[model samples]
Target: MKADSEFKKVLTLFPVVLFGLAYMVPLTVFSTYGIVAQITKGLLPAAYVVTLLAMLFTAFSYGRMVRAFPYAGSAYTYTQKSLGSYAGFFAGWVLLLDYLFLPMINYLLIGIYLNAEFSAVPVWVWILLAVTLVTFINIRGIKLVANVNFLLILFQVLFVVMFIILSIKALVSDGSVQSLFSITPFFSEDSSLSLVFSGAAILCLSFLGFDAVTTVSEETIDAKKTIPRAIFLVTMIGGGLFILVAYLGQLIYPDYNAFIDPDSAGLEIAAFLGGNVFKSLFLAAYIIGCIASATSSHASVSRLLFAMGRDSVLPKKVFGYISLKYHTPVLSTLIVGIAALAALIFDLETVSSFISFGALSAFSLVHLSVIAHFYIRGRKRSLSETIVYLITPLIGLTLCVWLWTSLSSSSFILGISWIVIGTLYLAYLTKMFKDKPPELTFDADEDIKVSS
Candidate 1:
């Protein structure tokens, strides 16, 4: 491994989008369908639409920031450069909660699913097996990860398509074509705008992958253009899949109260749509989806660690070192793999609480960064620039705050504790504010061409 080695620029827009969608795990809409359906009073599609519009505002901010700093580290890099080193450090630190634990959630999902299917095999074995496989693919390189994710995501999409077709068939068999065209999924006498917003807050987590694409900017060609385009495409495509699936699911099973269990409602719907065999296939697709999500998130966190390490924010020797032969961050990937083993001890609910906190925190900072870099600092205050840089991000920040208020008390406790620890570390690293924290170096000749 060479400390100075750069990542190979092998990714393009298509694979990058694949990585984002894989990280999102489009089939996730099925897993949470019942709970969201209940929350929205059967208006899942309306909730998804609200969530998508909110995410796009933040996605637009990400696009703006990536053009100015087309590097790895995502929000960490953007906030550090635009907002001051301290704010940037906290942004990266809090984001670590989201990036670091997401793979653990996937690993836990694999263990739980596999253990249920094959009771003879221990859950830890499945967790370890998944962690090993994902870690190995990530260590080999991003291209292989992208290729594997493409196949996994392809399976997920095929399953979603099958699910949609079956839902439509079931609906038509029971009713008429008019049954498929009802606005009840988007709005009904029982649902209200407040309930839709509540559901939107919950569904916001489904759009996590769009920002994860920014982590691979260093390994992407013409990253300034490609990364931003991939962000919007991923957000729109992922949101589209979620909204469509929710709409169809609501149509097929309009009576949300009929579910036996809200948490396992997807399984119930699967059983109804395709019977035992299709239900088994659905389980298999879900396991594959978990693997795909774990791999992408594993790769993402490793790159984020590498970025922080390269700037001497973390240990330069351990976290900063990239494999010369593989062009991947070997140590950082291994560290994430090891961290994922905690899945053996932690449950999904506990791990999930930390994710929304970190994601919302990073999103809020990115919006602020856009205003700091483009509006206040650059003095681009023309009417168009004001709308783009100020008003847009202001709306984004407000939505993030709204979502933040919806987070659980556990999320606040865990997130605040993580931030406190990070603050102490930053103090020591910067010698009690007597010194400025380390900064990422961007070379002038590095072809970081910004587009409007």
Candidate 2:
């Protein structure tokens, strides 16, 4: 493997945070609003609040880990350094599943939205167009993806702000303005703890992108400080967007039963709030948001594979190759793009569950890594440090387990099957635990090393 190729440190706080936001795709709040509200029985805001706080704990854990590792592998690097090679490999493998399917979910959403607008065009056409465009942007470089993501995220924010204002106006004109500030969106008589946590499990998907910031740590200047801040800010900002949109969206149509189809319910509300013209703008913004998300997803997943390949966990010649001129992982980018074509065969429900399961699994292990690294292995700590390192992560772990239980049975079966396959592959790689896996040094200079 060559050590000449490396990721340029062009990302500062803002661009890195923008990448996270784009990956999260704030407009997703509206895209899946009806189903979450249906699950929470009108208390969508409460669900987001729970999921946000839960994710924040995990976010803190990630921040701490990045300061120590500051590498491109995200949870894979953290868990490996904190726990062991085997644990890290599985962590990376699970996240690989998440990264692999995330582009599919984004393209699927684009296809679904486009299909709704132009019945003459098949959804597959829109999916292919989305994959092609995002792949091009990703292969160019992270800087381009960051620039594109910032603009698209701004457009998405404008659309959401416009939708909120229009919803308020529609309510005022109809003499029901009180719904805009009602507490029912946060908590209602029908809302229960079980239901809220269940909804949180679903909404956790919205927070998936924050951890991705850590994957770009090597490409970030002052990664130890910048990556942590980006992680925290992205989670908070994305959470705020989800809560605000869900709140206003609920105010517009407080009754989920009013939706003709819960899947496209947000479109119905868009039409009612601002007529067809505004609805068209809303659709355009959403499509752009999906493209931004797919672009970010591809960029991050390529980095992850590059990290793994650089470490000799996979084929170094292919997955680890980086374009010296572009400073991008060309082969890995194309691999993700090609794998996303599988999206055409699956439905939205299956992909959503797969993404959620893989993401939550990775998140749970990340929290555990914090405990493993700090409390169990690191030096003695003060009371405050103890709470930060141990107690908070334990709480985060419990919440993750609770959320994991909320996943569908199919998700559990499929997720476990993937894990089993990963274990089998690892056994082959290590010769049934008789040898140590390879490890690599990741830095801006692109140093490559192998440890037996």
Candidate 3:
């Protein structure tokens, strides 16, 4: 496409990675820390490690696809261009579940934490405030959003680092510095592979927004290189932070059963490690971090809708329209903010699982797209190439499937229902196979590269 018709390529590496981190929301490591600990039987670090490795594999596949496509579409573009139109439509549809609902889930999570701290404000009020603030920020534009995310991510990281330091100090004062290092965080008498894997499945939700970096590919400078690098960096840095926080958390609060409220376990750990002062600090950090997350989620989902709409998969007049002044998909952005209001009706645990299923399902398709694009279509027959194209993505695909199986039955029913709805819509769009699915028209001069 002509440069004038595409997203402005202004973002460099740092801001892009910050956007991804903001979307991932570093403080979320603690938000769900308690529940993951219970699942891992107190070996939270082990669970994080497993989840990180799986995410890394998926991140690699995403990087490969980003290099090949270098466009606005995320897994949808990748799968459609590499696999087929129908598969691509379904991939985009499944991903909509993640992109559209994520803001709601984050708003709900922040509401839970903030409500626990200030019950008089009411959680629904906080959710409303979050939707309003996040929607406004996103509609403003990507550059402004990136600048805001840089500050928000800095606050989240500082809080997490301070939390870790305080927890270590508490451990040392009780005994000595030696107490800071404990094998119990990774392995305890009750820990098992199955439990850790299950925990890893749930923990996968923390990695949801990393791939969202790809949604802004059109706006990224040197997108073919920058998008892939940002994906790997976000996954590694975010995963490392999660592992460290979980380790220190387990060390400070060793027993899962000891928590007064299993859902808010990190709160108890905050109190034990740093008293009421730190507990209050942690709550504030959690709320801001979630705000940052919702902001990024809104930005991403809006872009995805723009891509689909531009392709005529969605209503071209509405989702395809961009605000001439703000330079954003205003209608799409507003729809997301409205959808997030569903948080008022649903609880945290259920919505979180719902987001996970959508993300992992889309991730699995991305991995398959890599295999289909590289191994089957490219026809490159080399040992290293084979490993990169086939075996690596195979591992990623397997992990995504295993995680999908680990989700609750309700998630399956709900997620499948969403897909079924999408399938019907796709049929309508394709006219029951009488016509091809809608696709973006590219300029003949566009320097698009196929990985093959």
Candidate 4:
């Protein structure tokens, strides 16, 4: 019940930070370049400067919420605690899309990357191989998952550190100092500011691993302390690293588009700097990073489904079952696996923006929840907490609205439709399971009645 106790557990910040580095690296490089044309009108550095500031605003709200709740469910947990069940369900549902499809996206990228390494092998084979291995590892349990993540993150962070150092060296030796600020005018003479910011806002989607860690809160030891610390460290350090990489990208290749080919952005950057060896290294790191992202994402979807089943808001028999042997959520992980693979087959550009929309939607609610819980409820959070909770969330919400609007009206309709479907399902299940709430007295030895 105490706020201070949540911040007590020991975490070195490195392991806390390790899980997110995988998701952040590739996401930053690929997603950022997609928006560069709009922001810099082909100039890269100017666009990134704008992006760094926008990311900071959203991250502030995320950091505060993690400290506040420090529970499982990430956005799902926070929204339910503050706003009530229905709102929480929508938050969880939208986020399910983000988590469900991520492995597919990672697989798709990995498949493509591996195709170059072993040209004869099909990408799907590699995808199947990667997912098979990861699922088995995840099935082992959160502790093993964490260990896998710790190692993946270690490799990824080392790669990135080497990258930054190499990039700085290459840029300094090969290019002019003045080029750093050469593309200062981000909002080109001809471009619309609204559109440019929108693109940049869209680019911040890659900087979204902060709250992703929150979804793993249940499996975390001393979650109240560990979760918040993880959130802050990942966002602040990772966000800064992303910006540094982006800027280094600009420094290494003032004309970034030319340096990074449309098909292989990270590869081209590596090629532009140090040729095949460096490029190959970057690709290897990028793939490892994507796997890290998938690992965290896999854990998130499993936990979300587990929570829903516990609430009796989902099919208790289908989603409720945890792997007895591994003590991990079993059915939920299977469903997520199927969904992520399916997402790859029908993969749409709209999915990425929608991912951002869902993430920010939940993020907005979490920030609002902080205000509702700690401030409006007259709980223990200080004025500083109150201000951060209120102001930061509002800023993040407004940013969400801006980016949400930027999506084609079709994405808006799809986004809205998904929530509506989730609501109806939630209501149906709520009514069906109305009287079936899990009882404290219900013995594990007794009949485990599961409502369909």
Error of 3 at 150 (Å): 1.2
Q: lDDT tens digits, residues 1-452, model 3?
A: 12223356689999999999999999888777888888878988998898898899999999999988888779999988988888889899989888877888788887877787798999999899889988998888999999899888888889988987787787788576788777888888787988888888888879976799999887888888999999999999999988888888887777788889887887888888888998888888888888898999899999888888888888867787777667778889998889889999988767876788888999999999999988999986599999999999999999888877887788888898888898788778888878889777554336332110
Of 2 and 4, the candidate ahead on TM-score is 2
lDDT of 1 at 301: 97
The runs of at least 3 residues in candidate 3 whose Cα sits more than 4 Å from the true structure, single-residue gaps closed, are 1-5, 443-452
RMSD of each: 3.1, 2.3, 3.3, 5.7
Best by lDDT: 1
RMSD of candidate 3 to the truth, in angstroms, is 3.3
Q: What is the TM-score of each candidate against the true structure?
A: 0.96, 0.95, 0.95, 0.84
Q: Name every residue pair that clashes in candidate 1.
A: none
- Candidate 3 clashes: the total is 0
Order of quality (TM-score)? 1, 2, 3, 4
Residue-wise C-alpha lDDT for candidate 4, range 73-105, written one tens digit per residue:
677766776777767777788877677766666
Clashing pairs in 2: none
lDDT of 3 at 19: 92
In candidate 1, what are the lDDT values of residues 208-320, reduced to their tens digit? 99999999998899998999999999999999999899888887788999999887787888898899998898999999999999999999999999888888899978888
Task: Give the whole-model CA lDDT for all candidates, comma-separated.
Answer: 0.89, 0.86, 0.85, 0.64
Q: Which pairs, if any, clash in model 3? A: none
Give the least accurate 10-residue stretch of model 3, judged by summed lDDT.
443-452
Ranking by lDDT: 1, 2, 3, 4
